[model samples]
Target: MKAIFFILFAVIAGITAMAITTEQTTIEPLLTEEITTETITEEPTTFETMPIVGDEYCTWGPSYWCHNKTTAAECDATTYCTNYVWSENTKGL
Candidate 1:
């Protein structure tokens, strides 16, 4: 009778240990998510005009045009017109 009781107690202890280990086991995500990123770049637009003579001017500051080179230079110096260009002949040929 003592031997039978020992066997039953061992079985119960083994089952309890198995249940505790199962509960403590870590669970992994079934579906792992991968993240990806992309970068896009665009070209700047260009302004074109016909050539002229003696009517020099400068293009600067958000599509603004200056008829004087000095003013254009000032705008450039102030960083207001970083991409200034000189155009000729406002009065046309």
Candidate 2:
């Protein structure tokens, strides 16, 4: 019957169209570039001398003592540092 022939022709046309479209389509991975970062930092210094009077040393209160003024300054620059010098408490001579 003419209907059957028309159906068969339509099916073949649709198959051919699909095959052509699939061949024309491309699938490829995206291109990516790698990135890197580097940093240079200086090490902190330490002091070896004993504390002197009238000189301001770094301290966290009545306890911890920092090496020197510079070290105290660095500590104070941070979020967890307070610099102070304790006045010597002595009695008679």
Candidate 3:
């Protein structure tokens, strides 16, 4: 009776070990595929305008000006434009 019980226990343990090994192998392939897919799908970043420049002032073109005089000094330092005509209320030349 003891011999029979020992044989059954050994068989059950062998089967459980085999199942765990198979599951680990299957999951490893899935993880590798996910990492490859993520790397392939990544895209480079892009910008429509220059960074750190004010939106109200024209940073480009021949006729560039800073609309707000309060921040005109900062705008001129950043954009390099001398024309600071309009106040906060006024818009355009």
Candidate 4:
């Protein structure tokens, strides 16, 4: 009947309209390759003798040398490192 024909026409029109408007999507992964190289050798480092500081001297103190002087703030000021003759490291007379 006319109702059946109209129903078929409406379904065909809807399907055609959707096919024209909808989008198709696809995904792909990126490709990569590995590489290798030869190893290189290095020379060993050598240390030089430290120069002795003057009269302040190092001695056998509580920790290192007895020759160190304590600051008023109660901190180790060894960087200046004077008083080599009296330091704990040296063998003396």
Candidate 5:
């Protein structure tokens, strides 16, 4: 009878330990902050407002304000070039 009681006590303690050791779970609060972003735009450029490469550039002798000349012309018509001749007969004036 004593042996049977000891076994019963051991079984109850094991069951109680198992019940207390079961996995536990907890609830956590969620982040509620708002996020935002911004986009940027750039302006377009106009080629007409910019200076042409050889339009008024010239090269060779006394400079003259030359206008549109043939691409085959010897010198640029812009003020940038040096040593060029000016004539009413210049191609493309």
Candidate 6:
């Protein structure tokens, strides 16, 4: 009788452990992409009027004020270029 009780106790403990261990779970993706295709029509709020200068090509140099309105024929007629072209066109002697 004692041996039978021990065996029944062991089976009940194993069934209780298995019941406590069994759990449902859900897996999810790491990233979720959201698609948007709405045309955003932005109205012009501010106006930046550039002072119109000469329509000639200006020498893009240190002293020349070659801006957007000023063409290539405007400003100084020197062959010197602006200092902004460092990596793009860094020429040497």
Best-matching candidate per TM-score: 3
Error of 4 at 22 (Å): 1.3
Against the true structure, what is each candidate's TM-score? 0.28, 0.28, 0.34, 0.24, 0.25, 0.25
Instruction: List lDDT for all candidates, in order.
Output: 0.52, 0.49, 0.60, 0.47, 0.48, 0.46
User: Given candidate 3, what's the lDDT at residue 48?
Assistant: 86
> Each model's RMSD to truth, in Å?
25.1, 23.4, 18.4, 24.5, 28.2, 21.3
Q: What is the lDDT of residue 93 in candidate 3?
A: 23
Over 1-93, each residue of candidate 1 has an lDDT whose tens digit, in order, gives 999999999999999999888765633332344434532244567889866753443433434434344564544532333334333343211
Tens digit per residue, CA lDDT, model 3, 14-83: 9999999999998987777645677778897886876675545645432443534445454454233333
Please report, as a residue range, the 10-residue window in candidate 4 with the lowest summed lDDT: 24-33
Q: Report the lDDT tens digits of candidate 6 across residue range 1-93.
A: 999999999999999887666532121231343434542355558988886664433423443443321431354422333434223343221
Clash pairs, model 1 backbone: none
Q: How many residue pairs clash in each candidate at the backbone level? A: 0, 0, 0, 12, 15, 8
Model 2 per-residue lDDT tens digits across residues 1-93? 999999999999999999888765632222233333432244558878987763653434423333344554455632222323422331110
Where is model 2 more than 4 Å wrong at Cα? 27-93
CA error at residue 37 for candidate 3, angstroms: 10
Q: How far off is residue 75 in model 1, in Å?
A: 92
Best candidate per lDDT, number? Answer: 3
Give, for candidate 1, the lowest lDDT window spanning 10 residues: 84-93
State the RMSD for candidate 6: 21.3
Model 3's TM-score against the true structure: 0.34
lDDT per residue as tens, model 5, 1-93: 999999999999999887666532121222333333432244556565776655554432233344344422445433322235444454345
Q: How far is candidate 4 from the true structure (C-alpha RMSD, Å)?
A: 24.5
